[model samples]
Target: MIWHSTGRSEDGVMCHPVDGESWQKFDVDYPNFSSEPRNIRLGLAGDGFNPFGNMCNPHSTWSVVLTTYNLPPWLCMKESSFMLALLIPGPKAPGKDIDVFLRPLVEELKFLWQSGIRIKDTATNTFFMMKAMLLWTINDFPARSSLSGWSGQGYRACPTCNEDTPSYRAVNKVVYIGHRRFLDADDPLRMSFKFNGQPETRPTPRHFTNEDIQEQLGRLILRKPGKHPNTLKENMDRQGFELNRSKRSIFFELEYWSSLQLKHNIDLMHVEKNVGESLLGTSMMNDKSKDTSKAREDLKNLNIRRNQWLQKRVYQIEKENSPEFHKELSALSMGSQMDVYTYTACIINGVRFMVLSRDAQRKTQNSGVLTVCENGEKYYGQLEEIMEVQYPYDYSTVIFRCKWFDTGDIPDDNFISIDTEKEAYQDDQLIYASQAKQVFYIREPVNHRRNQNNNPRCVVEHVNHQNIWDLPSDNARVQNAYSDSVQDVDNVEVENVDIVQKDSSPGARLFIEFSHTFKAMLT
Candidate 1:
């Protein structure tokens, strides 16, 4: 058979093999271009025996060529590369015979390219990729009989099945190519071998079947096993894999297969480690090397101290400002009852004051008096009585009183009426009638005390007189008066007044007083 290089250089010299060697060279003959450059071609004889044994002599054939030239700048810096395809002459068989063999080789090349192997760098040169493709074809299939799995005479039966099946079946059977197929006694292609150069009559060895070969290959390719590093057993301890211990053989099979794959790539270590860490990181399992009991005890103590601190704060507030304390306590109680309390606060001026409750239940008991001091002075009050004045609206109205004014004196007459027409009397003209009588008049001296003793007394006419009754001489009367009048009025006023009590308890009474000066400040 003859081998030829297809593409031409510009020169008239044919771009052919230089000699019957592993390499060849040719020159490019440019007709009009000023630069004349030679291109190189390299070839490799593919592996596998040619059935005819008539293709270019395998050992002595030309495989590659490099031509001499004033190399281009790009080529001068580095050695040029080329892809080599070994051309095998087609058999004298009828119809599409060559194509049938070529297709499978091409498919295998494509598969190799897809598996993370870069065949070429487009930026550098396309030659490397082409070379990879050519390498795959040659390595995968050198000749038609290499694929057809038949001798030159096309009379050899399949080695595995020993049947006179189609050539295609013979190729597939002996080569162990394609997906595996399970066997059954009823199958037309049941295991059988050739005997005495003809189709065999008996079943072939089960081990020679396609299914058995594939199963063996699968086991060989696995990446994990009991004894392997990062093995299935180690992975189970680190991560974990569920398996039925009852099916020991099946379990071993899976692990063996997985281990084979692991050996081929250690990059899967990260994935294994992550999975293992996640499984082993659960909180339920305590580290045997650590003091787990001590840690738990410490957590318990911390919680106890936190609860004590909260109770102390509540007590202090209740003692200091009973009204505010009660309001907060009430709010907490209400929130607890409703089971919706999340946050509670009392803000004074722009500063936020917070009372924290652990949960809804704790909030119900939150109300109590809180005493707070400003400067050196201590003041006590209830939370509700403390007015909440917001910014911009009541900012200017916020005030605290440091001192108070003292007013002294009581009016003598409980009841008094004044007439506008009465003239003012001089001090000297006024006279005292009798010290014993609790009566006084304001009038001209001439008309004073006219009906009674003829002593002059000031008679003020058309003026209402206030009667002064003597105090009750006994405690019984006082008690009676208090029970009937004093108690009713005081109780009514206390109830109606918008006063905030300091104590949070329902029955506890605590009062907080803001002085009149403080009230004025609010306005």
Candidate 2:
């Protein structure tokens, strides 16, 4: 592990925290402190777990652990290297009250940073003042808020984006977007019409400096320790909205805390797990997925992703393809005397759909449809109408009428090009609502446009829907998403972007025993 101090492994891989910018910045700022590799550089990690493993009857037991980055990367994260600094027992998590329990540790850290303890170096047979600095805190997003005094929810939830976090109040939940702004300045995606129609020329949000954060803290009234912060509404007051800080974190008491380039780290495990679950739920189109009917509606409200809308449609198949499909039409079989009701919108398989007319009225085109044939062929169309037909026993089934765009050619290159000028299935245009999956279309950019007409040929994008496939368990889906993110980071896959691991560990035992006062306060 001593070789790790050289900053690069034998294979040229950066295998230690010593090679990172954060650690380098720390050294440049406090050269004296970093002069000795033996001088302790520590990280504090805290997380709550269910000891019982029974989620139904859960207990919040939090472990605060400290690790040193002085060791080589491989040995640093081993369980044996973990030093259990404090165990917070809880029938409930401490929340903001966690500061009360953390007071003893903060005081010790302050003492170590201010005045040093004398210790003999075993290898050199020389005595020196041993001192330590807490480089950063490590925790999941929720625990980070508790430890860092930053709220992890609402509009400014993302610490990196801060005030510039792009948020949309969806029909159901608040969602964050605008990752495209992080792209390169000349990236084509910045000017692409696929997302939200308008070009995203907004430069990346300004990174908050240490001075910026300190200025915010100067104006904030730190909340009392052990008391919960205000509700989201109350916190939206002028001061709270301006400065998202809930309290001045106890860590800021350390003299060197503000100078460190990175003050807190979001644990990769939690972030990856969350991102993975979101991907699986979406791919499987299940209830656990964030891509719900409300999500589609959110797209509509934002005037983006217009193709994702499930349109009210008349089901009509091409007579040449499904020749008998016209005979199955309820419209032809049932006379006008039969009661048929029309609806603008309906929910099917957790996917929300709107009629083409309704889609036009709303100015969001969601009426696209994609259907797969038994022979593996695919058809693309736009829904025209939605109808509910009454049966002899008063049973009812909804049907859709659609106008399918004509596919010009099955290209040798395997590209699908649809001609909006030509309609495909004219005579045979009817399908049971259950048989349809929503789809949307995007035209090739002007330079790449494959058609000559004003209405260019379009490409189809499937609207992710529920019940598409039998999905893996929650844990497995998360693992897949997490693994995918790690493997494909160079591709800029955003679903659940992985955070680079910054903290390292090695063997250590340094406990901050709780004082009687702290124990009494816990009780």
Q: List the global CA lDDT of all models.
A: 0.27, 0.66
| Best model number under lDDT | 2
lDDT of 1 by residue, 1-523 (tens): 0122223244755433222221221112212111211221222223233464667643322122122222332342244432333344433321113333344444544443233233544455653322111211111222322322222222223233323222322311322211123434455333221111122233333334435434433433223322455455534342111111111122122212222211111123455665566556533343432224443344233232222233445667877875556553433222111111112332121122222231123434221222223443322111222232222211111111111111122133443222213323222121111101111223233444475434433332222224322233453312121121111223343312221111223432222221112211222
Model 2 over residues 1-523: C-alpha lDDT tens digits? 2333564655755667677788889889888877766678888999899899999986899999998777767667878887898999988998867888899999998888778789888888988888888989999889999998888888788888877788867786677778899999999778765566557899988988989888877887644554355645454344754555677788888888888888889999888989999999888869777776777777767665443432211123432454545322433323222345555554445455676766767656667877778886777888887655543323345566788877755553545667677888786677766667888777756655444335566766655665332222553212121121112333443332212110111211111111111111111
Best by TM-score: 2
Misplaced by over 4 Å in model 1 are 1-82, 85-142, 146-154, 157-162, 166-523
Give the clash count for model 2. Answer: 23
The true-structure Cα RMSD of candidate 2 reads 23.0
Q: Give the count of colliding residue pairs in each prediction.
A: 58, 23
Q: How far is candidate 1 from the true structure (C-alpha RMSD, Å)?
A: 38.7
